[model samples]
Target: MLGVVRTLTALDRLLDVLPVLADDMRVETRFAVAEGSAFARNLADELHRCQAQVVTWDEATGKDFDLAISPSSNGPLHELEVPVVTLPHGAGHHKLRATETGVAQEVSGLSRDQLMHEGRVVPAVVGLSHPDQLAELRRNCPEAVPRAALIGDPCFARLQVSLPMREQYRESLGTGRRTLVLLASTWGRDSLFGRRGDLARELVATLPADYQVALVLHPNIWNKYDGLQIDSWTRSARRGGLILVPRLRKWQAALIAADVVVSDHGSLALYAAALGKPLLLGAFGHDEVVPGSPMELLGERARRLQPGDLRAQIDAARPVPGHRQLAELTFQDRPYQRLRTLIYQRLELPEPPWPAHPEPVDPFTP
Candidate 1:
């Protein structure tokens, strides 16, 4: 199997599926980090940690594979000669990106241009996490609909299994008897960092000793600007007791540890809501969000972060009333089993005798 990883986020999502094929002695999975994405950093090192064999993009293209799988649709996905499976790297597809002309915008991955290359569909199987997305695919890229497969999200499956480990995660983060406030931000100008870069610093400085503050930023921020830039940007926050979650991992542990979560329209926010945590929309980029999407609905149901005493707001926060609805929309039952079935069918192999299960996520690394 060929794993075409484009960015850190993509790598994170791909990790959820790779374990299913890991234990099979008959299979070998080689990873290749597709070039051109600014957020593609430490990929080789991360892959090495997994003990996965790393191949150059050139070599990946030169060799033949039984099947190729990628968590992202971006980059050179069409170059692979074998059957390719493409999946959403986040909580479904809820964001929009500008067209090449910069005049019009469309759903990021569902657009025909993104799903096709040279007048042909790119992925042999386009994985969809929800049933609603299939309708969206029909509306956006009708030609790709026949190829679309309703594969449940592997990341959410892992998170669900990790729910019982929340206390262990909190202990690892050293939140001893204190309320942990997790701030999550996506990338780009409209994200929390872009809107309020000093929010973490101010929260750490202002929140009493009974509360601990931690910031989890999208990997794009760290790789696009480099760690030194982020350190410079959040030096005071770090000094004032801010915990910046590691870029490559442990963000999920932070979510599991959080007593309350402040976020924009990122997938972390959606995941937090699904976990039934008290959620506050610190900053939401409405223009970039898809209308009537699950995220847009989250924006409407979630409490807005009002100005003035942040402590008072935190104290008064309640779990989003729509959280159960969000959870229902975000995941499907028995995802790992479904994923294993999908992959084996694509590989033309018989099903394994043992039941498929998602490994519990690792605890907080910091």
Candidate 2:
């Protein structure tokens, strides 16, 4: 059995990549869950056809596995006895320290020295999106380089379901006018570091009479901001001619329907970038590590949403070029081939046939 630990942020990537492993290998894959989560249940349902086992810490104690895989860097590393592989999590901009005792590897450019300091003794592998990240990994974690493989993110291997429910939801909300989708994520209060409810109210007050706005509240915010009624807030906006969508059948579907998106530095922004949706990055608090901010990576496609800069930013964003091709390149359309081959080589399993197409380009560059 191969043990896989996953984080909610990386669930889409995991689901896309792991199914290929099941198709090619004889080993059984079981997932270790941190807690019961809606995303976990969704993942289980998605992978049910693959026959992967879902296990908790108590049930995983005596389980045997040849290798361990973690979808995010933040998952508990000490749980598995076998070698571990990790996907890049968080900013993916800075180099993390690596260690010696436990083997840690990344699909981005992180150096061995950096990895060593971060408790990752293993080398970092280059994934599809960032070749620069691979170079950094080689520079920082040289020891783990040999084991490093250049497979892309698993999420990119399979195509995401672009459902037509966006139109239905829009009609349900009566938001036929210009619409903006706000994906509000909770990075803890300290990290969220931006405007609070007052900010939302300010934006609502300032929105043009013709424009309608929808707020997709983060699932975590319900618990964090206890007793806060998203419906009431959205309804207030609705009365003002701006329609707020508090409930979504599928988050990605909502993203597809949106003309523009406002979010902080979360993975959902990446999805918006992939979909060629104009982005407005709200940099409320993460000044220390983010530097120029992840929105800078989107180049001219997005701008930082400031207190009074909303109108200008939205105006500037109107002519922004979409990068659907770039998204396809970074999130390779069929990444399972590369991932499967790399895993086989690492575990000394026989290599499988390569897919018909060559590798995709990096979406970050022209």
Candidate 3:
């Protein structure tokens, strides 16, 4: 059994590669959650669909797994004795070291300088978030070049909606016909938007009058900003000829349906880019901002949203042909194939043919 320890965003990518492995191999997978939080429950629910077992740290000791797969940094799981593969969740600097603990692990997705600085002290594997990321990683961790595996952003491989749901989602959310989907989440303290209230108002004021705006709030924001009157906000936007739909829907469905998406630095923009939807990324607080990210790999398909520039950006937003093509080329390449092979090989299983028409798992149902 492969033990996966990570967040839902990380699991989103794992699910994409795991099924291909599970279908052809003899391995039974399970999740080892750190705590029984909402994120854990969501992860457990998704894993259950694959018929994988789910366990918590309190229930099962960390030593039980044959191999531990962490889609995020495994630095937190250093105490475990199992051989671990760490797939960093994002593109940035990472410090890899033994850290006063005895755990042999490799950290993927770091610049070359970062790897050079830390590789001397710890076992590390470097993978790029973009072509540049790989270049930087090699420059920093020269030794890691041989062992480095190009496992792309796991988030790129999330399950999308089925054809039926796609149509239903379109009808329910007004996806087609010059529509803009606003993916809202709670901005961190250091975010440029400062407060959720300020961002919401800015969105209301800035969006074009002719466009239909669907505000899909993240689950976390639903609880935190419950006091804000969504109906009133929608009414104000409606007066400007913008249709504001406040009811939430699955992120995948929204991404697929949207003509363009305006979101802060979150997984939604990534999903949009994967689907070839035009994306305008909003820069949040200080820490959330990365001047250039894998998102830029989308080229004209995406742009960083600037203050007082929303109208012009929205006007220029158009679905680019190479959006999904580049994404597949860069992140969904052979390294992902290797990860799939590793999962199957570990399970001692044969490979399954790729499903021509895999049904999208319903987010509401699971």
Best candidate, lDDT-wise? 1
Positional deviation of residue 304's Cα in model 2 after best superposition, in angstroms? 3.3
What TM-score would every model get versus the actual structure? 0.96, 0.64, 0.63
- lDDT accuracy of residue 62 in candidate 3: 57
Off by over 4 Å in 1: 98-104
* Residue-level lDDT tens digits of model 3 in 1-366: 555544554554455545444444345566665442333445565567647688866444455666666554433344445555556543222222222343123323343332333334122333344454555455545665664555554334443424345656666664446555554442344222334435445555776545555555543343343426555544665554444433233555555556677665444555566666676656533233333444445433456666676668777866545776655544544444556655555445655667322345343311
- Model 1, 56-141: lDDT tens digits are 88878875688889998888888777898999999998888555443136677788878899999999999988888988888888
- Specify the highest-TM-score model's number: 1
**Model 2 Cα RMSD, 1 decimal:** 7.7
Model 3 spans with C-alpha error above 4 angstroms: 22-25, 35-52, 58-63, 88-132, 139-146, 153-168, 172-178, 184-212, 216-249, 284-293, 296-316, 319-330, 334-336, 352-366
lDDT score for residue 129 of model 1: 87
Clashes of each: 0, 27, 10
Q: Write the per-residue lDDT of candidate 2 for residues 39-119, one digit (tens) a residue.
A: 344444434544657775666645466666655444344455566666554334332232334224432225433334356
- Clashes (candidate 1): 0
Distance from true location, Cα of 2 in model 2, Å = 4.3
Stretches of candidate 2 exceeding 4 Å from the true structure: 1-3, 21-27, 34-53, 58-63, 89-128, 156-178, 184-193, 199-212, 216-249, 284-296, 299-301, 308-316, 319-334, 344-366
